[model samples]
Target: MESVRVPLGERSYDILIGSGTLKDIGRHLKGTAFWRDSSARTAIVSNPTVYKLYGDTVYESMAEAGFEPVKVIVPDGEEYKTLLWAEHILGKLLSAKLDRSSFIVALGGGVIGDMAGFAASTYMRGIRFVQAPTTLLAQVDSSVGGKTGVNHPLGKNMIGAFWQPSLVWIDTATLGTLPKKEFIAGMAEVIKYGIIRDSEFFEFIGKNKKDILNLNSKALTRIIKRSCEIKAEVVSKDERESGLRAILNCGHTVGHAIETVTGYTRYLHGEAVAIGMHMEAHFADMPQKEVARIKRLIESYGLSTGLPKDIDEGALMAAMEIDKKALRGELRFVLPETIGSVKVLPVKKDRVLKALKRGG
Candidate 1:
C-alpha cells in the first residue's frame, strides 16, 4: 500500500491507496488512534449502486474490528447530490444515534464523498468522516481536497463547507469493475494533475497511455499515488483556497458551469472539465502547439475538448458569471500558460464568449 499524508497540522490525515485495502479498513481506522475504541458506531454513507457492489465486505470488516456499523444508502447519481439528500443522510445518522464521536464512512465516488462529508461537517456542528473513494475521479481529486458540498439550482457546489476527512481510503481494485465510460471519464482528472504541476508526469502519462487504460496494476498505482501527492502538497499550503489553492481550479470554472447548465445530466464531471481545460487553454498566452498537445491528450482519454452543440451558449455564459470562481460577476479562468503551468486571471465576457464559439 502507498500512503500520502495531507498535512493540515492537527487535521492532517493519510490517503491509503492499495489493491485490497478495503478489506482491512477497520484495522486501518483503529491504527489512526482516534478510532481505537471501536465501540462507537459508524455510518457508511453510500449510494444504492456502490453499496450493492462492496457494501458487504466493508460492513463485515468494520464489524470484525468491533465497530457498531450501519449502512446509510443514498440514491445514486450526480443529480441526487443536494441539500435534501444531505438532510436525509443527517436523519439516518440521527436514527443510528451517531454522535460526534461516531465516524461517517463515505464509501463511494465523488458525489457520495461530497454529500456524506457535507453531512459530517454540518452534523453536531462538525464530526469525522472517511473518504473511501471508489471511482478514479474521486480517488485522484475530490477525495483529497476537503472540498465537500452539493449542487444548488443556480450553480455547482454553491452550498458546502471545508471539512477534511480523517482518512481517504482508496482501493485500486475497485477500478476493475468500473464501467468503461466512467473509467475513461476519470482519466481527465488524472490528466489534470499532470497539467497543473508535474511536466515529467505529464510526459509519463503520454508515454504510458496503453498500460494505464488497460488497468495495468503498476500504471494505476503510479498515477493514483502521484495525483494524490500533488493534491496533498497543494492542499497543505492553502487549505481554504485563499490564493495558491485556486490554481487547482484549472478547468473547474467553466467545468462547473457546464455541469450546472446541463443540470448534471449530459456530461460527467470529468468530461466537462476536459472540455473546459481545452477551451480555457486558449485564454492563456500559451502557443497554439501547446494547446494542441492538451487537446490530443484529452481525446486520447476518449473525452471531447469541445462544447456540445445542443447547449445554449448564452445560458452557459450566464452560468459562468454565477460560478463560485467568478469575482462579483467578472469571469476568472485558471488559464494554462503552458502544459504543467497555469495562471488565474480575470477574463472579459467577450473573451469568454469567443472561447465558447470557438469550442463549437
Candidate 2:
C-alpha cells in the first residue's frame, strides 16, 4: 500500500491507495478519530449497482470494527445528480439518525462521492465524511479535491461546497469492475493532470498506453498514485479554489458547458471534457504542434475531440457564460500555455464563438 497526504493543517487528511483496501476499510477507519466512540454511526452512501456488488463487504467490515453502518442507496446516473437527489440523501441520513458526530462513507463512483459528500457537508450544518471512490474518474479527481455538489439545470456542480474528507481511501480493485466506456472517459482527467501540471507524467501515459489499456497492476498503481499526488499538491495549497486551484479546471469550463447543454446525459463527464479540451485549446497561445498533441492524446484514449454536429451554438455559449469560473458574464478558461503549464484567463466571446465553431 502507498499513501499521499493532502496537508491542510487541521483539516489535512491522507489518501490511502492499494489493491483490496476496500475489504479492510474497517481496520483503517478504526484508527481515525471517529472510531473513538463506542457507538459510532456511519451511513454507507452508494448506488444500486455498486451496492449490489460491494455493499455487504463494506457493511460487514464497518460492523466488525464496531461502527453502526446503514445503507443509503441512490439511483446510478448523472441525471440524478441534483438538489432533489441531494435532499433525498439528506432525508435518508436523517432517517438513519446520523448526527454531527457521525461520518459518511461515500461508496461508489463520482456521483455517489459528490452526493454523499454534499450530504455530509449540509447535514446538521456539516459533519465528517470519508471517500471510498470506486470509479477511475472519482478515484483520480472528484474524490480527492473536496469539491462536492449536485448539478443544477443551468450548470454542472452549480450548487455545492468545498467539504474536505477526513480520509480518502481508494481501493484500486474496484476499477476491475468499471465499464470500458467509463474507464476511457476517466482518462480525460488523468490526462488533464499531465497537461496542466506534469509534462513527464503526460509522456509516461503516452508511452504506457498499451499497459494502461490492459489494466496492468503496476501501471494502474503508478498512474492512480501520481494522479492523486498531483491533485493533492494542488488542493492542499488552494483548498478553496480562490487562486491557483482554478487551474484544475483545465477542460472543466467548456467541459461543463457541454454537460449542461446536453442535459447531463449525452456524454460522460470525461468524454465531454476530452472534446472541450480539444476545442478550447484553440483559445490558448500554445504552438500548433502542442495543440495537436493534446487532441491526439485525447483521441487515442478512444474519446471524442469534437462537438456534436447537432449542438446549438447559442445554448453552448449561454452555458459557458454561466460557468462557475465566469467573471462578470465573461467565462474564465483554463488554457494550456504548453504541456505542464496553464493559465486561468477570460477569453473573449468572439474567440469562444470561434472555438465553438472549430469544435463543430
Candidate 3:
C-alpha cells in the first residue's frame, strides 16, 4: 500500500491507497490518535446500497477491534445531499450518544463522504471523520480533498467547509462493482489532473485508456495514487484556494453551474465537468495542437464534449453568472495555457454567453 500525507499540521491525515484496505480498516484505524482513545465511539455513515454490501463487514471489523460502532444510512443520490440529510445524520450522532471524542466513518461514494464529513465538521463545532470512499470518482478525487459540504437549491457544494479528513481509506476492490458510466465519470477528474499539471500522465492515460476502462489493478492503483499525490500537493500549497488551488476548478466553476441548472439529475458531477472542460478549452490561449490533444483525450474516454441537447443556451449563460468563481460580477474561468498548465481568467459576460452557445 502507498500512503500520501495531506500535511495540515494538527488536522493532517494520511490517505491509504490499495485494493483491500476496507477489510483491514480496524488495523488501519488502530494506529490513529482518534482510535487510540478507547472511550471514542464511531459512527459508520453510508447509503442503503453500500450498507447492504460492505456495511456489516466494516461494523464487524470495528466491533472486533473493541470499538462500539453505530450505523447511519442516508438515501442515495445527489438530491439527498441537503441540510435535511445533514440534520438527520446529526440526529443519529446525538441519538447514538456520540461526543466530541467520537469519530465518523463515511463509507460510500462522494455524496456520503461529503455529507458525513460535513456532519463531523459541524457536530459540536468539529469532530473527527474518516473517508472510506468506494467509487472511482470518490477514490480518485473527492475522497482525498478536505472540501466537504451538501448541495443547496442555488448551487452545488455551496455550503461546505475545508475540514480535512482524519484518514482516507481507498479500497480499489469496491470499484469492481461500479457501473461503466460511473467509472467513465471519474476519468474526467483523472484527466483534469493531467490537463492542469502533468503532460506525461496525460499521455500515459491516452495510451492506456483501454486497460483503465477494463479496471486493470495496476493501472487503477497508479492512477489513483498519482491523482491523490497531485491533489495533495495542490491542497498543501494552497489550503484555502487563495491561488494555486483555483486551478483545480478548471472545469468545476461551469460544471457546478450545470449541475445546479439541471437540478443535479441531468448529469453526474464529472459529466458536467467533461462538458465544462470542453467549453473552457475553447477559451484557452493554448496552441491548437494542445487543444486538439485535450479534445482527443476527453473523447477517448467516451465522455461527451458537447452540451446536453435540450439545455437552453441563455439559461446556461445566466447560471454561469451566479457561479461561485465569479467576482465583482465578472465571470472567472480556469482555462488552459497548455497541457500541464492553466490560468484563471476574468472573462467578459458577452464572451461567457458565446462560450455557452458554443458548448450548447
Candidate 4:
C-alpha cells in the first residue's frame, strides 16, 4: 500500500491506498488505544446503492474486531447532500447513543463521505471519522482531503467545513464496479493534479489514458497514490486553505458554477471540472500551442471540454460571481502557468464571460 500523511497538528491522519485494503481495515485498525474500551461504537454511513453491495462485508469485518457496527444509509445523488440529509444522519448518531469516543466510517463515494464527515465534525462537537472512499473520484481526491460539506441551492459546497478525517482507506478493487462514465469523470480530477503540480505526471497520464480507463491495476495505483501525495503535501502546508491549498481548486470555480446551473443533474463533478479546466486554460496567458495541447489531452480521455447544451453564458457567469474564491466582488481563478505550475489570479467579470463564451 502507498501512504501519505495529511499533517494538521493534532488532527493529522494517514491515507492508505491499494487494492483489497477494505478487507484489512479491521486489521489495520485493530487494538488501537481508542478502541481498547468495550463501549466504543463505529457507525458506517453510506448510501443505499453502496451499502447493499459492500456494507455487510465491511460491517461483518469490523464486527469481528469487536467494535459494534451501526449503519446509516443515506439516499444517493448530489441532491441528497443537504443540511436535511446531514441532519438525518446526525439524528441516527444521536439515536445510536454515540459519544465523542465513537467513530464514523464513511463507506461510499464523495457524497457519502462528505455528508458523513460533516456529521462527524458536528456530532457532539466533533468525533473521529474514517474515509473508505469507493469511487475513483473519492479515492484519489475527496477521500484524502479533510474538506467536507453539502451543497446549498445557491452553489456547490458553499456550505462546508475544514474537518479532516482520522484515516483514509482506499481499495482500488472498488473501481471495478464503477460505470464507465463515472470512471471517466474521476479522470478529470486525476488530470488536474498533473496539470497543477507535476508536468511529468501530466505527460504520463497523456500517454497511459487507455490503461487508466481500463482500470489497469498498476496504472490506477500509481495515479491514486501520486494524487494523494500531491494533496497531502499541499494540505500539510495549508490545512485551512489560507494559501497554497487554493491550487487544488484549479477548475473548481467555474466547475461549481456549471454544476449549480445544471441543477447538479447534467454532469458529474469531474465532468464539469473537465469543462472548467478547458475554459480556465483559455483564460491562461500561455501560448496558443500549449492551450491547444491541454485541450487535446482532455478530449483524448473522452472528457467534455464544451459547455452543456442548454446552459446560458450569462447564468454561468452569474454563478461564478458568487463563488467562495471571489474577493470583494472580483473572481479568483486557479490558472495554469504551465503543465505543472498554477497560480490563483483575480479575473474580471468581462474576462470570465469571454472565457465562458470561448468554452461554449
Error of 1 at 299 (Å): 0.6
Per-prediction TM-score: 0.94, 0.93, 0.95, 0.94
Q: After superposition, how far is residue 345 of candidate 2 from its true place, in Å?
A: 2.3
Q: Please, what are the lDDT tens digits per residue for candidate 1 over residues 1-360? A: 889999999999999889977889987777667778544688899988888889988998888888889899999987789999999999998999998788899999999999999999999999899999999999999999899999898656789999999889899999998888999888988888888998789888889999998888889999999999999999999999898898888888888888878877888888998998888887788898988989998898789999888888799898888776889888998877778877789888998898888773
Compare candidates 1 and 4 on lDDT and give the better one: 1
Write candidate 3's Cα lDDT for 175-271 as tens digits. Answer: 8888889989999999999999998998999999888888888899989988998999998889888898999999887787787679778788899
TM-score-better candidate, 2 vs 3: 3
Candidate 4 residues lying further than 4 Å off, grouped into runs, are 31-38
Q: Model 4: per-residue lDDT, tens digit, 1-360? A: 888888878888888888876777766777666446535588999998888878887888888887787899988988899999999999998998988788889999999999899998899898889999999999988987688999888656778888999889888988998888998899999999999999999999999988888889889999999999999999899888899999999989889899878877878889999999988888888787877777888899999898865789999888988887999988899999988999999887888888777663
The per-residue C-alpha lDDT of model 4 at residue 352 equals: 82
Output the TM-score of candidate 2. 0.93
Higher-scoring candidate on lDDT, 2 or 3: 2
Relative to the true structure, candidate 4 reaches a TM of: 0.94
Against the unseen true structure, what C-alpha lDDT does each candidate score? 0.89, 0.88, 0.87, 0.87
The global Cα lDDT (0 to 1) of model 1 is: 0.89
What is the total number of backbone clashes in candidate 2? 0
Runs of candidate 2 with Cα error greater than 4 angstroms are 32-34, 153-155
What's the residue-level lDDT of 89 in candidate 2?
Answer: 88
How far residue 217's Cα lies from its native spot in candidate 3, in Å, is: 1.4
